[model samples]
Target: MKPVVQLLYFGYHQAMSCIFPVAIFGTLALTRIWEVPFLHRYDAILLILLAVQYLMYSSGLETWDEIKVICLFHVIGLALELYKVHMGSWSYPEPGVSKLFGVPLYSGFMYASVASFMCQVWRRLRMDMTGWPGGMASFALGGAIYFNFFTHHFIPDFRWWLTALVFVVFRKTWIIYRVRATTYRMPLSVAFVIVGFFIWAAENIATFLGAWTYPDQREAWRMVGVSKISSWFLLVIISVIIVAQLKHVKAARRAEPG
Candidate 1:
């Protein structure tokens, strides 16, 4: 295939893989512009996402296993949101029946959307990995990264240290993905940064759409700081590791004797 054709194919698959995220963003933009008569924006978003999920499943755009993964991330994300809101890292600041301790239930769908993208892209791009860290190392790193999101608030921030460890641990890891008949590989760390950067960009858009607000944005909206890329970078690592481990487990189970 020609280089231009391959690029187009790659872009097409990527867009297809972003169905869930796109839906969430579209809902955010729409709700920001138009108020629901009888429903709060957050509650409306939750309902819309639930309907979207059903549609995706009914249409065979998502598998049962993928849905399970997305559900897990939703819970994980909600837990983080609860803690973050308590700690004043950010606030929903929106009134809704779905609000729990000042955090909206619809917020979990944001994180679930990331998992949805990972699962979809993994399948669409025929993704594989080389030199994946062992389960112990990967899970431990993921755990540490997650805890740091909370611990950093109370103790000295260790994000940079964890960031360093990520590079060291994934030094030999590479992601293999296909575009049409051709396969391409990139360092896993580079992939993490790429995904994180895009997520940060999306975060800016989400904030602008009043999906949520940072402390600084209480009075007016502003771009999220570039430093947030590191946070999202770590978050992307955790999301990727979880999805990868789940895929690995499924593969291993399939390889077992029936």
Candidate 2:
């Protein structure tokens, strides 16, 4: 295949994989401009996301297992949101029946969308990894990264240290993905950075749509700081590790003797 054709094919697959996230962002943009009668914006978003999840499953865009994974990330994200809001890292600053301790229930779907993208892209691209660093190592690193998000509030931030460890842990790892008949590989760490950067870009859009407000944005809407990319980078690592571990487990079960 020609280079331009391969690039187009890759872009097509990436867009297809982004259906869930695109839906979420589209809803954010629409709800920002259009208000619903008898429903608060946040409540309406929650309802819309519920409907979207159902549609995705019914339409065979996501498998049952993928839905479960997305739900897990939803819970994880909501937990983080609750803590972050409590710590004054950011806030919803909106009234909604669906608000839990200040965060709208719909907010979790933002994180679930990330999980949905990971699962979708992995399947669409037929991605596999070499030098996986084993399940225990990956999960431990993931757990540490997650806890650091909260602990950093009370203690000194360890994100840069964690970032360094990520490089060391994934130094030998490479993700292999297929685009059409041709296969390509990239350093897994590099993939993390790329995904994180895009999510940071999306975060800027989400904040602009009034999804939430950071301390700086409460006065006026401004671009999210570039420093957020590091946070998202670690988050992308956790998401990837969880998805990769689940895929490994499924593969192991399939390999088991019947």
Candidate 3:
């Protein structure tokens, strides 16, 4: 396909991905729309990341505080990705990135902004960060999983400096156990740790076995299929921990405390 044709195709594909939800919302606006949920009405935990605006409006969480956090996460994520792509850390499926940062400016904003909102919805529905003890364990475990999916071997040459992160973060977090976990806590933590380790190992093995290899992977770390999965894993885990520590949105109450 020609470059122009590819751009057109991407635009159309992105449109379709975005259109269905808007269409549903439009229909609801016309109809009685009785399904307006209070807060996290359904288990859209990850799904909410897609239907952001609809949930924001319907969930009655258009407050400034919520909006600020959503905006912050979006901006940060977009900036981080854009920087990474520009620095040759990764590239998108489409060359549309450079149109703004080589992609389209507003286009990037639209998607990133929407994702930020979804994070808020997640926090609100997760019961507002209540009793989150064993949190660091999962974050330590899950985050490594996340980074591996995209850039398993793309670590910086100087990153060996960060090698001491494990001992440092672990010791600090262990000492500052301000919060606590409930019944579901241990299981959730275990899930992320196991998943992170498994995926990290798989990525490494695949590379060795010639499955998926990181082409621009750092020369220092690229093994046939072996690389230290610790950084990405720890990075992910720490990120999750930070997010867990953040405030969650509360379901609105019918009776005003006043």
Candidate 4:
């Protein structure tokens, strides 16, 4: 089998495998494109994350800087996740599945890609990255901690608590740098459609794969039009955006007239 052909096939399923995530995401985007009311505060985000994920998949990574930072986190995360998988930290719906990269795709790939998309969403939203370096850099340090999560060093609850704590610290540091980032006024109608569609896609994909085991999801095969994964994904994306935005703000300050 040709490597190129194999890649294309893998890409196709990889993208298709995320159909639920996409459908939820698309519903969010198309809705915004048409100028509709948001389903909720999170509607716009669903659109953004899924959009970025699909774009990354189909276009083969266009943003070098974004992907670089995102992938940097991914490689670290992958190491931890792979170790967990080997040690049985968590089990997937699919058993013993490995990917072409030999690192396995069932869970790790989804997280890195999904988190990457979420990061872009937050960056575009200007939620996290614009802030003072002292505390901001400290939080940036936490990304490493998050990367350290799932490794043998930290327990799962410890990692989760640490993430929440870092987010709080990052938010406070970000407030200090509040004057740093350029704020854009987004249209309410546009925001709603885009966010709603993307979330819809993500949820759909999760449900199709039996990941949406939430009690509220009545339809076994079809998503409930809402799910925890969307919420979690949105949170992660916002966290990424905040980190990137602060980095941007720090860079801009460095370039300013002294």
In candidate 2, how many Å is residue 34 off?
0.9
Task: Candidate 3: list runs displaced more than 4 Å.
Answer: 1-51, 54-57, 60-67, 93-98, 103-164, 171-184, 187-232, 248-258
Which residue ranges in model 1 land beyond 4 Å of their true spot? none
lDDT of 4: 0.46
Q: How close is candidate 2 to the true structure, as a TM-score?
A: 0.99
lDDT, candidate 2, equals 0.95
How does model 1 score by TM-score? 0.98
Tens digit per residue, CA lDDT, model 2, 1-258: 499999999999899999999999999999899888899999999999999999999999999999999999999999999999999999999899999999999989999999999999999999999999998899999999999999998899999999999999999999999999999999999999999999999999999999999999999999999999999999999999999999999999999998
Candidate 1, 106-140: lDDT as tens digits: 89999999999999999999999999998999999
Candidate 4's C-alpha runs over 4 A off are 1-62, 92-103, 122-144, 151-164, 174-246, 249-258
Worst 10 residues of 1 by lDDT: 85-94
Colliding pairs, model 2? none
RMSD of 4: 14.6
Which 10 residues in a row give candidate 3 its minimum summed lDDT?
Answer: 175-184
How many steric overlaps does candidate 2 have?
0
TM-score computed on alpha carbons, candidate 3:
0.38
lDDT for each residue of candidate 4 in 72-158, tens digit (9 for 90 to 100) = 655655665567545544333322224323333333334555545544444433443333345456555545445444442454434
Please, what is the TM-score per model? 0.98, 0.99, 0.38, 0.44
Global CA lDDT of candidate 3, please? 0.40
